[model samples]
Target: MLTLLILISVGLASAHHSGEHFEGEKVFRVSIQDEKQVHLMHVLANQVEVDFWKPDSVSQIRPESKTDFRVKAHQVDEVEHFLEEKGLTHEVLIHDLNKLVTNQFDSLIRSSGHSYEKYNSWEKIEAWTGQIAAENPKLVSRSVIGTTFEGRSLYLLKVGKAGSNKPAIFIDCGFHAREWISPAFCQWFVREAVRTYGTEIQITNILDKLDFYVLPVFNIDGYVYSWTKSRMWRKTRSTISGTSCVGTDPNRNFDAGWCEIGASSSPCAETYCGPTVESEKETKALVNFIRKNLNSIKAYVTIHSYSQLLLFPYSKNYALTKDHVELNNLAKAMVKELEALYNTKYTYGPGATTIYPAAGGSDDWAYDQGIKYSFTFELRDTGRYGFLLPESQIRPTCEETVLAIKYLSNYVLEHLY
Candidate 1:
């Protein structure tokens, strides 16, 4: 505990810690045609250290599907040999992850202040929340939802024309540390709301009727850790008592079928569900807020990246949600809205069936709490870039995402009966 606290303080106090860069890593996309191939892929993941990009875990790798994962440079040869031995068809989506990280910036000119097209650091984003709120007090105001385990304040921006007793939509981004594009979209959404409140008819109407509770970065400690320590870090920065690993997956730290499947009980796994439900302060903060505002919050929208999916609940199992038909229709419309821009197609359905079954997801929790319009937006790129989505694509990706989100927001407004 002492060591973790000291490290957290050091992480907070320092302007920069020497980056633990991702060098010589390759993202491989593998296609599975049968259960044998799926089992082989699972075996491969267990045998070597790899980061699951598409399905999230070995258990979720279904037959007749393509999955993307990253392997360290040292382990690439072994992975290649094993894939050959197993006769698994695969392609290298990213030749080198470090190169992708370096090239993430569209322009070498370097981003100044806070721009919509570039990924901002935690410091910059934290500052932007306060600045944006102060600048637009009428349409946007900021509040601290709770403090993270590392003692950093979690900022929640209430974006709408100031009002009371109005139905609200809770939108959160950057649930996973490595998914940089998630936070980018949240910032972009807020920017668009403020920019278009008066001129954009949809934005004007939605703001007049509903409020948006925007959480820019839910896992602040993990985000900072991703920037400073490991570029692939994907959990809260809090350390488990007896383990050397430092962080729990905040997305899996909620109480929705917690750690049942598609999540890990081990402290070291990527989808570690923490010691218990809401164990991480970040998770607790989000849960408490949502529970308190469950009445006024009519919809819950969580933003994530690299899959281009819009999914509804029941991630813990194959059981269809009771509101399946209505949610499915809304999802279909939203994806069509997404594709309207740049022809970027999106697949939408139940989270368990559409992608993979992940228990303890915030979306599932929200839906179970009676927020019928719960949706998880997995934004942009099927897998060409994986989590290293470039800065150049941010504008188009977020621009199109705005369409789908606006569509959902409006649907929630009309259907709030």
Candidate 2:
């Protein structure tokens, strides 16, 4: 039995090592000098296996914008030569991605137990949700909303004082599997809510007036795949019929402007929109829950990373939302509060104009469902580390983000009428 256990351990280690195919891969920060260069880059992306680290997809790239993309080691020379041929100026943001991946987990070994300063795996986070809820019965509670494609329980924590039919703000993280920091912030937010229930004035006031529905990780299957199979995996883990692609982009599986823009129809594409609207089980579950509680949920906040943007509705088109003035002012105020801590700046505006026209996003869908204060937060270090943000920065990132969320929650509370 001991020998069998040793063999299993070796096999697991080998599997993990095999997944680190990004060794020596370089992330290039390319500056789009003109509109033509954006088109050229899109063409280049089609001809190669380059992964867009910022702006998400090639369609979002624009003139005068700085785009970050990752290219495998073998294609580095070819990509560099192609960029030179196109006369585009670019610099290497990450010289070796594997080195950063290695450094990201170095602090984990020094800790005696689970530490919020370091990124925790899905299993750790799953266990944490129950433990936190059990420990703080009055201010927190946990419930499984649904199950993932891989059969993992999707846990949602309710953080607030026990009350009847209180207005609530819905916040979710880890929509993309590889965005470890996203889930980290969700966990930190819950911890902050529970830890500061009575001690902190803003948080206490917000909790007294509102309930926070926090989904720590949305893409459970893909999140697990990222931990065990590939560190850079995005999308869900459900297999589509007639194709080998494993997952759909949950953010693009919503009903609002489904698959219309900034999304891909190809199953193999990173931004694959899925076979149909709400095709993925995870998205369907979220939609059902939100639709069931549409009356009480006033705001919808979905968190993402590596862009440092706070965006509002109308992501499917350039048309302004009816609540444009109110949403914009709220975003600006929240961003100002975020910036006050550590001087970290955040860009705030409508999703379509502020970033790109991404169809089927949760915030846009929620707004369409009459949840007026819908917002999406792209957190931390525009593109310095991209999805591989170091563990050292998690605390500060969550801290500043908490301030922004508090500002928004307080605003939502005042205007809950």
Candidate 3:
């Protein structure tokens, strides 16, 4: 009985990670013969079977039928053409799969070698935030907006000079959980802010005028799980109420497009949206905090990895915003600044045209919530070093990113207040 109980518990735990288990080589589609079966797929040279993030009531996917997906035969370009010609709305291929995986491995090795004096673990991110706040009492302060699913404190480190309430810039990282570089960049930004305040008049001036509130790692439970088990793990670890699947992609869990268009309703998927909107505690905390600070926040930026593209809102659909032109120009300028620093290039454009149509993304949410300068940065090498970006590239990546942020910051300063 004891052994059987243990087995059941383990099976239940594994269900969250188990979606419609597909070997990386197989291309299969979930068909909704009677209903629309739309799920988000991250296109590469090949379409690997990653579970789509689904909402609560309809989390379990009872696939009406299976369709073979010949990803390799149809190259990413071919796939894009196919989707276009078919008038099918979905995430078409952008980068090749081999290059993406290879670059990810390379990045991991490279990052492992770099030595950042003040780097901290998932558990220590807040402690480090506290230390930095204490050290720079006048310019920095920390707030615990709320706790993550597993009760880890979600901290917002606000950086700026003492005085009047300034127009704020909100930046969040580690939203996908496995993108260590995102969180790393957040820490690096804070460190640089502390080091350059007095010397770099430009940075100092911006800090004096604007406040930067950064959430280093938004998905703490998933991040901790990635560190412990799977390096490629995405989404949170909150268990769904029925049918055993756990975790919802916090990114997809946002209420903006909830589970429409680019998201799936399968509990076993990678981009699984939890039981409901703001289902994940972390996302709820973020939403609550953002609602409170909405009036002050002028620009909102969320950092992610691999594609080296700077994208703007309407990720849920292709509809252009009123400020599309200005956003595009700003993105172009930011990428130019990034390239000027390290000769590294980045594509910049609207989210749907730039990459894929993603629903419920924080950037789109921020934009919808009236933050005009909402942007999402897909950082680092386009493919030579995807998610597994190395320690060695950390400095260069952070440096280039800093340049882009500075560019945007300068632009925000001129526009906001």
Candidate 4:
């Protein structure tokens, strides 16, 4: 299967064309010491073409938080000058966005096809869905849950032994296009599932009784655009009517809060919730699948990256869920297991309090739909690397993540009543 994954990489190289170059663009991190600092950055964002790399929006930036953003080469001087003038403490995290992006490739030759260590193109990942299922017939099978606006298949892989009426966990990744590490972890997970099914006792038992529905890439069109046009692109690649703006943030496209807060109404905004709930085909597809499988899906895991956070429900607001204690305990246990592997620290709690309030998020939607174990994983490197985590670290990131996910799954299995 690994060999087939490598072979799949060879043919899809041309699908990704030379994208927008980030040559002198730099990523900056600002230390927000007070509401004054937060307000200052928020005001600056509106004045400049600043892109928030971490918080997703200026509204989410809070006092005492460190925000990461990318400023274009032409605007860096002005942005820095403004920061200095305002007395906001800040530093360059990525000196050269282009160099960091280039280093992320880790190889110029591109000999291999689909690799767990390397970020794979959508074309390669799409093909691997079919190939990996064929290679491991007993443990894996692929089906199309839906298609993107661009008509790419929304490949869903069911990973586990065939069973009569088993409960399952729904796991998805790549909701935002430029978060390449998100999809990388999904592929690594499926690979580990089939590779260690019988040899690894924990995975063995988990697969014996529970099925895992894995969507390797949820935002297909935008992921392709990120590879072929813009490396920092985030959102679905659907064209909104009456505007030239391209896409909606799928994370904010769910029905949980339906863009009530921590989301944008403007079509061009990064966190645009779409015209309405489940408006995007990808959002509809996932909603329909989970709805159809609601009876058996005991847990929901939506993977994302660069924050190393394990978050639970109520992302739409600050109110705690009824299962707050139970969920918090589980999250704490999961973090413990994850950190044990590499000593990679992970903070865990309710989403709104832990990070920022993000309405229409899939985890919140899933939890509201009765999947009590719904969780979101923001994986790896707090922001030393951000979305462009090096290929060399993929293995450890995935390895540690698997520990947390497996722990969560075990908890679900034990509590499924």
Which candidate number has the best TM-score? 4
- Model 2, 1-417: lDDT tens digits are 766654554454345444566667999999998879999998998888988877788888878888899999999999999988888899999998877766565333344345688777787899899899999999999999999988889899999998898999999999999898999999999989888888988888889889999999999999888888888899999996798877898989999899998998989878888999999889988999999999999999999987899999989889999999999999999999999989998999999898888898888899999999999999988777888887779999999999999988888888985
lDDT of 1 by residue, 324-410 (tens): 999999999999988998999899899898888889999999999999999998988899888879878999999999998899889
- TM-score ranking of the models: 4, 2, 1, 3
lDDT of 3 by residue, 1-417 (tens): 766654554453344242422133212232334333433222321253232222111223333432223344334355556456544444423234333332332222212222242223576676678888999998899999999878888989999997676899999999987677888899999989998999999999989988999998899888887666655678898986676876887888888788886676788766666667788889889988888999999999999886788999888888999999999999999999999987988989988667666687888898999999999998885534345575557889899999999989999989984
The better candidate by lDDT, 1 or 4, is 4
| Model 4 lDDT at residue 213 | 99
Report clashes for each candidate as comma-separated counts.
0, 0, 21, 1
Model 1 spans > 4 angstroms off:
1-19, 108-110
Evaluate all candidate structures by whole-model CA lDDT and list the values in order.
0.87, 0.88, 0.72, 0.90
Per-residue lDDT tens digits of candidate 4, residues 309-411?
Answer: 9999999999999999999999999999999989999999999999999899999999999999989999988888899897878899999999988998888
Residue 408, candidate 2: alpha-carbon lDDT: 86
Task: Choose 1 or 4, whichever is better by TM-score.
Answer: 4
Off by over 4 Å in 4: 1-19, 107-110
How high is each candidate's TM-score? 0.94, 0.94, 0.76, 0.95
